[model samples]
Target: MGPKGPKVIHVGYTPAHVEQVFFPHAEVVGDLGLSLARLARAG
Candidate 1:
C-alpha cells in the first residue's frame, strides 16, 4: 500500500494469480488500456 492507499491495477488472465502474487485488494482487469482510460476519465 502507498501513502494514499493501494493504487495498483493488475491486468492478467488469472485474477487469482494476481491476488496471490501482487495485491489481494488490487483492481484486476482483463483489458489494461480500457481500464486505465476509464480511470483517467473518471479521475
Candidate 2:
C-alpha cells in the first residue's frame, strides 16, 4: 500500500463505542461491545 492508500487495522476495545466517536472512517470491521463482560463480536 502507498502512503495515500487505504489500510486495514485491528482495534480491540472493551467498550467499543468509546473510540468509534473519534474514528472518522465509516468502514469499521470489528467487535461491538459497550463493555468487556460481553463476548467479542464483529461488526
Which has the greatest TM-score?
1
lDDT of 1: 0.61
lDDT for each residue of candidate 1 in 1-43, tens digit (9 for 90 to 100): 5446766666554575543435655655567677777778988
TM-score of each model, paired residue for residue: 0.44, 0.19
lDDT tens readout by residue for model 2, 1-43:
3445565343453323525334323333345354323433432
lDDT, residue 31, model 1: 76
Single out the weakest 10-residue window by summed lDDT for candidate 1.
Answer: 12-21
Once superposed on the true structure, which residue ranges of model 1 sit more than 4 Å away at CA?
1-13, 16-22
Give Cα-based local distance difference scores for all models: 0.61, 0.39
What is the lDDT for 41 in model 1?
Answer: 94
